[model samples]
Target: MEAFTRLDAKIAPLPLANIDTDQIIPKQFLKGVDRKGLARGLFYDFRFDEQGREVPDFVLNRPEYKGAGVLVAGDNFGCGSSREHAPWALMDFGIRCVISTSFADIFYNNCFQNGLLPVVLKAEEIQQLMDEARGGNHVASIDLAAQTVTSPSGAVFHFDIDPTRKDKMLRGLDAIGETLQAKNDIDLYEMKRALSQPWLEEA
Candidate 1:
């Protein structure tokens, strides 16, 4: 996973609540396990019509919000069944940060692991950002180091994250990367264990 220290980019306003994983990347696109090529399928149902033409009104489909890196969405974002692909699709689509009042527990955890910042702010704060996002070309500046999100309207909001997850994100550490951080300790433990429990080893 890439390290996400800061982001200053246009915000895509998605004001609908209870957006589940299926709505994010429809099940039809779930065949491939790889993260690549998921961007085309990101919000597939929402972004395309039955004939596969792009929907002009969707926030992501609008020309003004193209290349948006931040998303200001409605409450209970990422609700429904737990699926890691949702965050994968968001990241593949260049969304580095998502600002919402609340998020599903599983999806929120998935974001950190995939290097997507799931920011939890008060409802009023989110509304303020959402409004700013609606205005054309308004950028949202986020600093993970400071845990702050600065909206285009000049309002600042602070957020909290788990210290461990924060550290992992700052260092670009995925599960494997995290384990590598303790390589020395793990090596020593393994060596000691082999000597102390030799009989447990396979012949």
Candidate 2:
């Protein structure tokens, strides 16, 4: 996982509510477990027609948002199945941060684990961000350390995040990375246990 300290990038507007995992990366594209190449599958249905031709009407297909790293979406974003692939797809597509009024429990945590910042702001704040996103090239700066999101016009909004999760993201530590931080302690404990119960180790 990559560190998410601060980001200043153009925002992409995804204003539809209840965007589930299937819509994010349709099941048909779930053939591979690897995270690579999934970006092409992100929002597959919305981005392509039945014949697999690019759909010009999709927000992501628009030229202005082609390289967008921030996404401002509607309420209940990432609802439905608990699929880790959703965040993988988003990250592969260069979305480092997502601002929304609400998000599914699993998806929100998945974002943190995958190095994607899922921000939960008030409805009014989200709407303002959405408006800013609609304005092409209006970039939003997100400071994970400060726990705030700032719009291009100098508007700032504060948000809350668990201190532990914040620290993990700041250090680029995922669950495995966090556990490895105590490697010495773990090794010592295992050594002591082995000495105390040699029979157990043999078993």
Candidate 3:
């Protein structure tokens, strides 16, 4: 996972509520476990038409929103099945942060694990950011260390995040990376256990 310290990039406005994981990366695209190539399938249904052409009206397809790194979405974002692929797809598509009024618990946790920042804000604040995202600039600034999101209009909104998760994201530490932080201790414990029970190691 990549470290997420700060981001100042275009914002894609997705104002629809109850956006589930399936709508994020459709099940058919879940053919592989690798995170690569998932970007092509991100928001597949909404980004493409029946004939597989790009949907002109979609926020992501619009020229102004191209290369957007922050997504301002409606309430209940990332709902439904707990597919880790959702965050993978989002990050692969260059979305480093997702701002919404609310998010599903599983999806929220998945975001942190994958180094994607899931930001929760008041309904009015979300609406304001969404409006700014759809405006001329379509850009927002996010500082993970400061726990702040600054909209295009220069309005700064503070968000709350767990300290442990915050530190992990800052250091680019996933579950495996976190565990590896105690490598010396783990190695020493294994060595001591092996010496105490040589037969167990042989088995």
Candidate 4:
């Protein structure tokens, strides 16, 4: 996972509540475990029409929102099935942060694990960011270290994040990366166990 220190990029407004995992990537596109190419399937239904043409009105397809790295969304974002692919798809599409008033529990946790920042702010704050995202600039700034999000209009909003999760994201440490941090201790323990029970190692 890539470390998320700060981001100053375009913000795409997705002012819809109760966005489920299926709507995010769709079941048809969940054909592989690999994270690559998942960007093509992110918001597949909303981004493309029945004939597979790009939806002109969609925020992501709009020229101004192209290359957006932050998503200002409505409440109850990422609801429904506990699919890790949702965050993968979002990150693959270049969205590193999602700002909403509320988010599903599973999806919120998944975001941290995948190095995607899920920011929860007051309803009015979210609305403010949403409005700014819709403006011509469509850009925002986020500082993970400072736990702050700055809207395009220069309004700053502070958010709360768990300290452990914050540290992990800053260091780009996923679960495996975190465990590997104690590699020497783990190796020493294994060596001691093997010496104490040689037969166990042979088995």
Candidate 5:
């Protein structure tokens, strides 16, 4: 997982509500478990026609929004079944942050683990940002250190994130990286336990 301390990127707007995991990457693309190659399948159904030709109208398919790292989406984003692949696909598709009015609990948690920032703002705030994102000249700035999102129209809004998750993201620490950070203490504990109970160690 990558760190997300601060990001200033073009925010592509996807203003549809109830965007479930299935609509994100689709089940047909779930055949592979690795996260790296999932970007090609992201929004497969919406991005392509039955003949696999690119759809011209989807926000992601538009030339102006290409390479956007931030997403301003509608309410109930990431809803439906709990599949970790949703965030995985998003990250692989170059989306480091998502701003929405609401999100599903499981998907929200998954975003934190995958180092994606899921910002939940009020409905009005979303509409405001949505308008800014629609413009071709706008870029959004998200500062995780300050818990602030600055829209292109010069409006600033505060968002809440778990302190632990924020800290982990700042340090670029995944669960494995976090555990390795306490490697010294773990090594000492193992050594002491082995000496204290040699029979258990052998068993």
Candidate 6:
């Protein structure tokens, strides 16, 4: 997982609501467990036509959003199954942050675990960000340290995040990384247990 202290990048607009997990990466692509190749499968149905050619109508297919790292999306985003692949696909697609009015309970937590910042803002705030995303000269800056999202025109918005999760994200610590941080204490505990129960260890 990578640290998400601050990010200043162009925002890609995905205004459709009720975007479920299947629409995100599709069930076909879920056959593979690896996260690296899931980006090709992100919004698979919407990005491709029956002939397997690129669909020019999808927001992500638009040229301006090609390298977008921040996604401004609609409500109820990530609403379906609890697959971890949803965040994986988003991260693989280079979207470090997803801003929506609301998100699914499971998916929201999944984002933090995967080093993706999922912002839940009010509907009005989301609309403003969506408009800024469409502007040619606009850019959004997300500062995790200050917990603020600022627009190019100087508008600012505050967001709330759990401090524990915030600290983990700032340090680039995932579940595995969290466990590894206690390595020395874990080793000492194991040694003490072995000494206390030598017969158990021999058995």
Q: Report lDDT (Cα) of residue 41, candidate 3.
A: 95
Residue 28 displacement (Å), model 2: 1.7
lDDT of 1 by residue, 10-69 (tens): 998898889999998888888988999899999998899999999999999999899999
Give a tens-digit lDDT track for model 6, residues 116-183: 99988888998888887788855789999899999767799999999999999999999999999999
Candidate 1: deviation at residue 7, Å?
Answer: 0.6
- Measured with C-alpha atoms, the lDDT of residue 34 in candidate 1 is 97
Report the lDDT of model 3 for residue 98.
96
Candidate 2, residue 21: Cα displacement in angstroms equals 0.7
Cα RMSD of all models vs. native, in order, equals: 1.6, 1.3, 0.8, 0.8, 1.3, 1.4
Candidate number of the best lDDT = 3
lDDT by residue (120-166, candidate 4, tens digit) is 99999989888888777787899999999999999999999999999
Task: Name the runs in model 3 displaced over 4 angstroms.
Answer: none
Superposed model 1: Cα runs more than 4 Å off: 194-203
Clashes of each: 0, 0, 0, 0, 0, 0
Which 10 consecutive positions of candidate 3 have the poorest summed lDDT?
A: 130-139
The C-alpha stretches of model 5 lying farther than 4 A from their native spots are: none
Candidate 6 TM-score to native: 0.95
Error of 4 at 1 (Å): 1.3
Per-residue error at 3 for model 3, in Å?
1.1
Worst 10 residues of 6 by lDDT: 130-139
Model 3: per-residue lDDT, tens digit, 67-135? 999999988999999999999999999999999999999999999999899999999999899888877
Residue 123 CA error for candidate 5 (Å)? 1.1
Backbone clashes counted, model 5: 0
Better of 2 and 5 by lDDT: 2
Q: Which stretches of candidate 6 lie over 4 Å from their true place?
A: 199-203
